[model samples]
Target: MNLPNKLTLMRVLLIPVFLVFFLIPGIPCHYLLAMIVFIAASITDALDGHLARKHNLVTNFGKFLDPLADKVLVMTALACFVDNQMIGVIPFLIIMMREFMVSGLRLVAANSGTVIAAGFWGKLKTAFTMVTIIAILVYLSFSGDFNSFSLACADTIDRVCGWILTGLVWISAGLTVISGWIYLRGYWKFIDPEA
Candidate 1:
């Protein structure tokens, strides 16, 4: 396997670690650990693609699995956040619906002898999603500290983070829709019913 593919696999390996950090309760610094792990995994996502392109080591397997890995990691994180009640259901639904729709469209394009690749908007969406998830997780990790006080500082921080997360979620969702449309448009010419 090429370095890029190895990096992609490393990202897949980190998913469980990320989840573990997110789920662990009252670990003193669980939120910080989760944020660090998530950031590292997000970095690997970028490094894999850059290495694949710059080193001329891109492979068919990488092409097929890289995006799939991204989708899985992102969708997993989103589900976990929703399950933990860190984010709203509407945003999760929008983001997940876009992912499913795009994945289905990509499959259709693949069968039609075309590969739909991630564009700028898609990358931006991923970045925003990662940022939002990290922020929300960190907030959750600290919200426990506010349980005793009527006007706790932790509660204030959580509310601020909540607003920021909501904004990021909407931005990510908008970008997801735009990116999906771009890919669909690119593949439209090749998707013939008779073919």
Candidate 2:
């Protein structure tokens, strides 16, 4: 496999490691570890793309799998966080639904001989979503009754983080919907009009 593909596979592999850190009980530094792993995986996502484009190493397989890998990582993290009650159900559902809708649109565009690359808004949405998730995870990691820290301070921080996450989620959702609509409109003629 090429370097970019290798990096993509590495990212996919990190998902389980991220889960292990995020889900394991009684681990003193679970949240910290999870955040580190998540950040590392995110970095790989960027590195692979840069390398692919810089070195002319982009492959059909890389194009197909890179975004899939990102979706899987983000979705899995969001699902796990929701299951653990670290994040709310509504945001999780919105993110999940957007992913599915976009994936469907991508498939339709692919069949029509159009490669719908990730646009600026889509990239911004992903970056903001990742930042929000990371912030939430960090808050969760530190907010428990693990020490003698001021409860009020922790609560305030938690609330701030929650608001930030919620705002980012909504913003990302809006961008996702807009981008998906734009893509669908671009490819509307490709759809089987008779069907």
Best-matching candidate per TM-score: 2
Clashing pairs in 2: none
Tens-digit lDDT track for model 1 on 1-195?
A: 889999999888988888887778666577667778788888989999999999999999888778878888888888887887776788788888888878888888788787777788887888878887777666655565334334647567656767887787788778888887787777766665665
Best by lDDT: 2
What does each candidate score in C-alpha RMSD? 2.7, 2.1
lDDT of each: 0.79, 0.82
Please give, for residues 11-48, the per-residue lDDT of candidate 2 as tens digits.
Answer: 99999999998888677778888889999999999999
57 Cα displacement, candidate 2 (Å): 0.3
| Model 1 accuracy (lDDT, Cα) | 0.79
